[model samples]
Target chain A: MSEIVVTHVPHKRSIPFGQEAVGALSIIALGAIGYFLYPDDLAFLTRLIGIAFLVLSLDLVTGYCGVATLGHAAQFGVGAYAAGIACVRGITDPVALLAVGVFAGTIMGLISGALITRFRGLPQLVLSIAVGQLVAALANKLSWLTGGSDGLSGITPGKVFGIFNFDMYSRTAFLFSLGVLVIVFVLLQRFVRSPFGLMCRGIKDDDLRARMIGVSIYPRLVVMYGVAGAVAGIGGALTAISTGVVGLDSVSFERSAEVLVMLVLGGAGHLWGALAGTVIFMIFEHIVAAANPFHWMTLVGLLLILIVVFAPRGLIEPVLSLASRFKRKGEAA
Target chain B: MTNLLEARGVSCSFGGLHVTRDVNFKLTAGDRVALIGPNGAGKTTLVNLITGDIAPSEGQFFMGGDEITGLSIPDRVRRGLVRTFQTTRLFANLTVADNVALAIMQRKRITRRFFSSSTELPEVRAEWSEILSHLGLAKLAYRKVVELAYGQQRLIELAIGLALHPKVLLLDEPAAGVPHDEAPKILEAINRLPSDIAVLMIEHDMDLVFKFARRVLVLAAGRLIFEGSPDEVTADHEVRRAYLGSYADARRAT
Candidate 1:
């Protein structure tokens, strides 16, 4: 009995390590291959990857952490404007732009989180909406700094590492965005599996129970909000860098709603789901717009409604179910 | 012996109606006491006050001789004072083990290190399994709380509370909705908790109350009318008249 107990103590050591290793290696390989083969398309791909990262951040807080916010676009816009202004001022360092974006986003997230923490349900949702509107108003009102309705467009791309200049070819830009995305994905995966992540989930389940168990929900939530904001800010900064422009649309309600739709369509609980959703939504937009730009919004709206009504868990869950069924069939054979 | 928990001059009112009126109570380490009263006697309200869910109009509370009257619920819990809800508050979506593990993790000072993995921590996993096994919930560890029966859900709630390793466990009518057959198991488990961990339970069932509590406190219309042994409480005519009117015949039969 003692021998069995001692051996059984380390049972968690069998946590699918081999599968995770393969997955990580494959992601790195795919990123490298994509970076080399499609250098010219990197700029667009970079923006896509950045948007995916932002969506993942939102999903982490809203989906897994159980915080619902409608004001996240404010953070995204702040970062974009900060990076754009920095670029306009001749500060073209990628690292500096990232820092400025992250800092601005963190501050915005903290303020919004603090305001929303005291509320729940509709009240929280309304507060978030108000925050988004407030940021949009600021962006529109601050014409001199943000370039107002004209938008901040005068941007010069500097070298990423003093050797690789951000040419219109977009090779370096794509690699840079992909690199950041990979890092964010890895970090978020670790966070969600950590003790803090578990506590967030616990708070989501029952705030009162979490309190009785000794978890302080408020401060932890504030920190989570800040982290998520920083991620979104980085995505916004990437957009500014790749496209070399920052506009009032960055803080628009439409942008916030679009991200929310992507998160829901992909599934909120999984990190990869956010990426899948963003990619699919972007692809659909591209295809639809190319075919006929006039009715794209209608088609997308219908698609979202159908997805919410028929497959509320999102497309990823159905795919997972299908894969599991195949595995069962294989075993039976 | 010094009381593990003490509340003095505790009064609370809602708008115009007084819910608790200058109530006084104390529980020493190893003590097992019951708060017995009819519905609307402010029994649950009193629990809420002690647990810091609601602030008192005027009162002072002490745990281990340290004043904790103005602390938050989570703060009180950190100071080794904790309470279970009248209604079981289990995480319906999560597995039983995850619920227990969450409770255990709650007490720790968790840092925001985004690169660290949780499942890799041997200590967390081991503690999780240990608590699950202790509650005889090892088999149902993987089952979601919603999938469990009411009795089982109650057990899981208790398991969650137990995982906190609270010095003082306040149970608000733990067996209120629990089936009679399953009540004994819960009562037994409560009885077996470490003697140093004082228990203050509010229960309506006379038989279960008498069987478990060494002493009983009677409340009538938010005031402490009587405090004595279970036998003494049963024998008190005034106490019986004030709160046990419907149970008079039942009391005599017992």
Candidate 2:
């Protein structure tokens, strides 16, 4: 007599409404409850959330599109300044401010993309860093428009849709920023899953092969860069609206590096990874600063190094793998 | 029948060294021709010129009645001409299926939508499955390219070229790195391809050349020394002298 045994091979499941739809609904519900309950802390959370969106945009270009860039902060800064300047000049209309920010970001993205696309390898990286420095310097030197080192202050947060005033109370600002983040996140998700996204990945893997297959790399790069920049700029505009102030830090190299760190910390290729990285990094920073003022940076630096050396896939991937493993184990049992 | 591809007075030089000098050749549709030459006879360079990898410094190239002298590689591919690299150029990280699927999808006019997964259309999947099955790679469809053997990688490269639906396929040393036993399968696949798709191959394996190629073009020192049937080429005094320097010894063994 012989006993028969069965072996199961795990197969990937098709997209189910239960997973993503429930996840999205839960996020919105949580945000809505947080908006209404913690009105006092809403403004700060709004700014952090906006920064998260900006980091996601960076990941789209650098991680998915495979165009390593250090000048993405320049586009963000331009959008911030556009909205800030508009506010200072009494342009309180949200639509008008968003328009200016998106337009300016798109133009700057196109110009910078064209300049950088001509180069590859280290030259491209250097060019992107130079672009960031140039934009930051322009913001500083043009004291008339940018308000110089003192930074643009006295940005009056106007009412949203003529209903709730964006004030220190923070209810309106939090909802507004959350709304923007959700829209941008959904748009980016769609973009990455499209045929264009596949082409971008192909270009990243082998530009020569892509070109041989009739996929023009330059035009696609330009378009991706412009769109990513525009999204980042919108993120910056959200920052301006929530904080009611725009500073030179918007375009600072350190800020750019911080965003990159957030991207790496979460996982570059996945959108949610960037968001998780940003939130965790921010929360950790707050906790460390409160616990030890002088050693916060050192602790953060050490943490980043450890993560890079050991878990290069970022914190989220390990969690995801573990979750999947548990699910398979449960099914086996 | 008119030649599907014609190279008239096509000469190319690299910084004062003429690699291909006034070399003329014609490839009619349904032709299986072998390009044999010494180490630096510019056979690969001639393949590059024919495939539009580079422009001819002097002279012209025509494919299917159209002058394609300055067309880009992709444009040339779109016009039903494709070539494999001397070195296998597979996307190392992608699965064998994805590599072929990419070629098939790119040939279509599908608009790129972002953030969505690659929806393998029925026709595209059918084409990919057909090509993979034909190349005996259906079992290895999901395997990463780097995990495959050298000969398997070469077959995958050939499968990619076939997926392009080319009117003419140029194989640059297809049997270069394959083992002795694997050479026959590669040659047999090339022989079994549809008659309408002409094959122009650069090869060093004499047995493969003699067994598979209907016609042979010999290049010595970047000049066309002989062009005719395999028997005619073997019989040419200069061809035997230029290529098979030890023909006398080989004849004794036979």
Candidate 3:
């Protein structure tokens, strides 16, 4: 008993760091693979990074905090529009554009989160969808600013840090997105393991208990939504910067639904799970759509069913279990 | 001295069914009061009212002379008014240590620190380590709450309530579902609680109530019927009638 206690006590402080190191390494390795394997299709990979940020943001609220939201794309879209508008208005520095996206996403997250977090379960989900549709409608109505259905275009962001021009081939754009993904991933790894993140998980599991433990559920949730929005904003800004266009599709309900699918596909709560799900789902979609553009949705639906049936916790659970099992065996040897 | 917790004419009703009627009680520092009554006697309802789970339709609650009728549940808790549920409500997926650490974090107001790691915080680690060890739960600290036995989970619940540093701790059946053999350990832990903090336990377990509580409060039909020492409680006509064949007859047999 004493031995077990001794061994476990110190393990907590050290274990997550090892997991983080692996997460960072895998992200870098995957980014390199995308760069080398599909040099001509860097734009697609950049788009994946943008969506990855949205999914990660969703995981913070929906996965960790257990808030049901189907309108997360509102944050992503708001970020995209914010960046695009800033660029068209002469604030085209890529880094500055990303900050603008973050700010926009945070504000949108707080507003929508405040309204949505007031309820629970079904009402929350409905409120999220409503908020998403409302944003989409507003964007469509404000045609002069948002370009309505045509999307806000003619965005040509300046070179990153006065170097590494975003060329027509999208090489610089891909690297920039990947770089942002890595930085965000690292920071978020720390963020989620922090005390705030742990409290959110507690609230997610049992909010009544959290309230009893002296947690102001609404305010914490609103703040978390703000954080999640900021991350989603980064994703949106990346999309605007890399693609040089802000489309109505960016904030569409369909986009929100698809990103949610990606999040659940990889897994929800784990940060790495969010990244893995995005990569797998997006890559799978790209391949399937290319193979059969007319019936691609059917294929995606089938894949979702299979995944839900088999890996209900998402694909990351089994992989993580196997990894832990292997580590125990290694230690025994 | 001002009472640690005081409920003055506290009443609650769900539409027409009054659950707690004109309920009044006082608990000062180092109180070991047992609230026992038949099922649906408004015992849990009273606990809920005090913990701010359900607001009293009438009357006010005071903590150290401050009226707290409109305070939120968390606000009441922040003022050192904590509770343990009849059925254990823990973070089932979290490790036992994390479960306790969360309350500690809430108390220390470090739950908002997003950049630093929770596990590596030396202050928190020291606090929870001492708490778990003191409760004889050191071995199980790393285990998830779901993995623990029901009795152990109840102890974790107590651990969490303690972590809140409560002045008035309301425990609703801390040993309701524990195995007969393991119930004593929970009682021992409860008995070992800090001497200064007042504890009011609502329990149907006669033996536990008799052993742990110096004073007993009996309720029937949502109203306080009697309040006195354990010996006086067993002899009181209303208390004996409230327990009927169970507690009163058991005392007679013993």
| 1 versus 3: better TM-score goes to | 3
Ordered from best to worst lDDT, the candidate numbers read 3, 1, 2
Clashes of each: 0, 15, 0
* Per-residue lDDT of model 3, residues B33-82, tens digit only: 99998999999999999988888899999999999989999999999999
Looking at candidate 3 chain B, the ten consecutive residues that score lowest on lDDT are: B242-251
DockQ winner: 3
Error of 3 at A158 (Å): 0.7
lDDT (Cα, tens digit) per residue for candidate 3, span A1-333: 122222224444256478568778888899899889889889899999999999999999989999999999999999999999999999989999999999999999999999999999999999999999999999999999999999999999998999889998889999999889988998899898899999999999899899999999999999999999999999999999999899999999999998899989999999988988998999999999999999999998999999999999999999988997897688659
Sorting all predicted structures by TM-score, with the top scorer first, yields 3, 1, 2
Query: Which docking category, incorrect, acceptable, medium or high, applies to candidate 3?
Result: medium
TM-score of each: 0.91, 0.87, 0.97
Candidate lDDT (C-alpha), each: 0.81, 0.80, 0.91
The number of the candidate with the highest TM-score is 3
lDDT tens digits, residues A249-300, model 1? 8889888888988998998877767877998898788778779789998898
Model 1 lDDT per residue over B57-155, tens place: 998999989999989888899888877777889777777777877777666554344555553456666877776666566777766788898888888
Tens-digit lDDT track of model 2 for B29-104: 8989999987999999998888777788999988878899988877888887888878887767567877787788
Error of 1 at A287 (Å): 0.8
State, as a TM-score between 0 and 1, how close model 1 is to the true structure: 0.91
